[model samples]
Target chain A: MSQLANVLNITKAPQPSCQAQRLTASKSLSARQQQELRAILEQGLPQVAQPYLAIAEQINASPDQVLAQIALWQEQGLIKRFGLVVKHRQLGFKANAMVVWDIADEQVDAVAKLLSSCPEVSLCYRRPRRLPDWRYNLFCMIHGTDRAIVEAQIAAIVDKFALQAVNKDILFSVKAYKQQGARYTKKGNCHG
Target chain B: MDKQSRQATTPVAELTALDKRIINLLQRGLPVVERPFLEIAQQLGCHEDEVLERLNHLMTNKVLTRFGPMFDAVCLGGAFTLAALAVPEPEFERVTEQVNSFDEVAHNYRRSHDFNMWFVVGAESAEQVNNVINDIESKTGLPVLNTPKLEEFYVQLYLPA
Candidate 1:
C-alpha cells in the first residue's frame, strides 16, 4: 500500500457514521446472467423462509446457485451494496447537504483522501469541473438529523482541513422528486 | 412543490422503537439464506413474522424507497450521468414534470442554486443517455449540464435512523 492509503487505513473517527470505504468503478458488464440477476436483486428478496429458492424459480436457477451468484457479483463490484435503501429524511436525517469544493489540481487527490476519511462524509467523489458555470470538482455528501448538526459538522471539516480559503457551495436537497434504483434491462426481473 | 415530491424537512411520523431497530439493522444487509428475516429476527431478538411485516409496511408506505441490491449502473453496461437545469421560476412546476417524464431519470432533486433542478439519468448505453439528455433539453427548452463522475474516492451510505 502507498503511504497515503496506509495513513487513511489507520485514521479512524471516534464516532463513525460510515466506515472509511473505497469505491472501485466498473465500466462494462460481463454476462446476460448478471444483468438478470441485477434486475431481480433490485426488487429485493421476497420475505419468506426460502427467498433464495423463490428467486431461483424466477430465473430457473437453484437456491445455492442464486446465493453463489450474489456473492460473486458483490466480489466483482457489480453490486455496490445489497441492503435496505431507506428514505433518509424519513429516518430523521432531514439535513442533507451536498458540498462541492474547488481544489487545486495537485491537492485534489490528497484532499479527497482526507475528506473521505471524515465520519460525517457519507459520499466523497472527484467529478469533472465544468468551467465557468460549475467550478467545484470535489463533491461530498453530509447528512444529519437537523440543520444545526449539519452546519457544525461542515464547520469542523473546514477547520480541520484548513479549507477556509476554498471556494465551495453547500446545496441542501430541497425536495426529492424521484429516487429509485437503476432499471437496467427491466425485462429480466418482471414476472407479471 | 408537487404531490410526488416529498418534503425533506420533516421526519416521517409514528415510528416505533422496533421500526428504528429494523431500519438500522436492515441497512447493513440481509444475508443470502433460506430464511434471512429469521436470522435478522434472531439477531434483534424479535419474531420473524414481525420483521417481515414491518419491512413490508415500510416499503408499502414509502418509508423505504428501495430495498435490496444497489447496482452500479455503469458496471451493468449502462450509462449514468448527473444533469441539471435552471428553470424559470414561473415554469418550475411544469418544467419539473417535463424533465421527470422520462423513465431513464432515476433520481431528481431540487437544490438551492441557480442550476436548481439536478437529476441523474441512467440508460442502457452512452448513446441512450445522450438521447435522454437531448430529449430533456428540447422538451424543457433548457440546457442540461451533464456531469459524470470523473473519479470515485469513496461511496458507502449507512445511516442509523
Candidate 2:
C-alpha cells in the first residue's frame, strides 16, 4: 500500500474501524509525556482556583509555565475549545442527529455563515459534494427538547430565510455506539 | 503533567509549544476500554497515572471541553437534523436553559445572528426526532426551523502542524 493508503488503512483496517491518522499522531509523542498527560487528563483537572498551580506542583512545574504553554497551544489551534463534555442522554436530552443541507453551490457560504452563527448549531462545516449519489455542502446541528420542537425550528428557519428552493433532510440518530473524542492513545504501539 | 498543567485557566488564545503538543494529543480523544490512559502514557513516555491525572486537570480547569465518543448519527440510526431559532440577546440564557432542559438535546450554544439560538437534537427514531422539534415549537411558542442532512460527509477538524 502507498503511504497515504497505509495511513487511511487504520480507520478501515481495524476490526472496530479505527482511524489510522490517530496512531500516526500518537507516535509523534514520546512515551513518557504521553503517559503523564494521559494520566492527568483522565484523572480530571485539579480542584481550587489556581488548579494549574496545583497540577504544576504535582508534575513539578510552575503554574505560570503550564499556563504559558497551554496558551501557545491554543494560539496554534492545537487545542480546540476546552469545556465540559456532558452525557446528553444522561441529562435527559437523548435524541442526537446531524442535519445536512443541500445548499445552492452559490449560497453555501452565505447559508453556512447564517447557520453557524446560531448557538444551537454547535458544529458547522463545509464539505465537498458527493458526486452522482450525494451532493450537500453545508452542515450544522440542531439539538432540542423534542422532535416537534426540532421540526418547528426547521420550519421557522425556512420561513425566516427564503430557503424554500434548498433541498434538506433530517438524518436522525438511531443509536450512538461511540459518541466521544477521537482516541489517540496507541500512536506508537501499532506500527506507524 | 504538573500542578501548573492542571490549571483550567489556560485559555485557547495563549498556548505554548508544550501546550500545543498536549492539546494535539487530547484532540485525538480517549481510547476505548479500561486503562486507556496507559496506552497514551506508553506512547508519550510518561507514567499511566500521570496521563490520567493531567486529563482530569485539563477537564477540571476547562482547558479541554469534552473528551469522549462522538457518534456517527447516520450509522447509529434515527433522524439527525439541524435547526435554529432567532433568540434575542436578553432571552438567550433563559431560552438556552429552557432548550437544554430536554434530554435529546446534546449540545446548546449561542451564535451571533438574529437566529442566534442553535442546538443539536438526537432521537431514538426519526419520528421521535421530528416530535421533539414539534414539542420545542409549542413550548417556546416559536417556529422550529429544520435543516436536515440531505447528504452526509465525515468532518475532522485537525489543523496542520
Candidate 3:
C-alpha cells in the first residue's frame, strides 16, 4: 500500500462505529457486496438496455442483488445522485468562473441561499477564509458560453443582491491539468 | 494553444430539439429500472432505440463526459479539499507538474489570479488531506492556501441543452 493508503487505513480504524451504523440503517446487503457495487459504479453505469444486468455480470453477482444494493444505498444517502455527468466545456460553455464573496458573517447564509437559487450558478458553498491571505467566505461558480455573458450574469447578481460594496473576485479557468473520477477503493481495486 | 484558440477550434455539433430535450431530462437522473431508456423514451414521447442512439452519439462526440452514480466520498470514509498555490510566473509549469504528480490530486486548473494554480486533493481522511497539502508546500517551496468546505449550501449543476 502507498503512504496515502496507510494513512487512510489507519483513519478507517476509528470509524468502525460509523460504518456499523450505516450498515444497520441500510442492511439490504453485506459490506463486501456494497464495496463491490461501489467499485463498479465509480466507473459509471453502463448505457445499455439492461445496465444493472451488465453490472451484475461483470461483478459476478445476480442482477437482483445489484439492483437491491443500489436502491439501499440511495435510501441511505450513500449515493448523492445517479445521473449524467455532463462536460459543460464540450456543450459550448467556454467560460467557467469561481466567484468568491466576502459577505458579513450574519448575512452569509442569506447570501448563499440567494446565490443557490440562481439558475446560472451551479455550485454554492461557504468555505473558511484564510486570514492575512484569503478573506472570501462564500464561493459559487458561474458557467457561460463566453466571458462577456458570465460578466453580465455577475453584474446582474450584484445588482439584485445590492452587493456593490461587497468584496468579490472572479477566477476564470485558463487551463485544466487533470479531471477524473475520485478514487474511493484501495489502490489496486477495480478502478484502473 | 491559448483559451481563445481552443474555443475557436471546438467542434460545433448540431443538436436537434429531441436531443436537447433528452439531454435536459437525463441530467436530472435516470430511473433505476430494468429498462431506463424505455422509461425515458416514454416520457419524451420517443422510442427507446432513439433515446439510446442519441445518448450513444453524445458520448461518442464527447458531449457527455460520463454517466453514472456519483458517490459521496465522505460517507465512504474519505476526505477532500480545495487548495491553491501562487507560483511565480517563471516556475508555473514546474509547479503544476509537481502538484499534479500526486495520485491524490484529482483536478487541477489554472485560474486568472495570483493564486493561479487551484486543485483538489482527495484522501482517506482529513489528516491525509493535510499531509498532501504539506507535502505539496514542501516540495514546491510555496505556501498552499487550504480551503476545505465548512458547509455546503448547494452543489448541483444543471445546464439546459
Best by TM-score: 3
Q: For residues A14-118, what per-residue lDDT tens digits would candidate 2 score against the true structure?
A: 122223213322333344543454356444444233455665666665555555544433333333223334323332333444566788787665566555544
Encode model 3's per-residue lDDT on B5-110: one tens digit a residue: 5644776666778888887788667898888899999999999999889988988888876777766567777788888998899999999889988888866888
**How good is the docking of model 2, by CAPRI class?**
incorrect
- Supply DockQ values for each candidate: 0.47, 0.04, 0.46
TM-score of each candidate structure, all chains considered together: 0.76, 0.44, 0.84
Q: Candidate 2: where is the Cα deviation over 4 Å?
A: A1-44, A178-192, B1-161
For candidate 3, what's the RMSD? 8.7
- Residue A160 displacement (Å), model 1: 3.5
Instruction: Report how far residue A35 has shifted in candidate 1, in Å.
Output: 6.6
Question: What lDDT score is found at residue A140 in candidate 2?
Answer: 62
Ranking by TM-score: 3, 1, 2
User: Candidate 3 on A2-87: residue-level lDDT in tens?
Assistant: 42233232211011122423465344556676667777788777778889889887777778888887776676656666667666
Tens-place lDDT per residue, model 1, A1-192, is: 254565465332222112112332232322554456557777766766677888777777677777777766667656656566566666667888889999999988878888887767877777788888899988888988877898899999998778999999998888877765346534221100
Best by lDDT, which number? 3
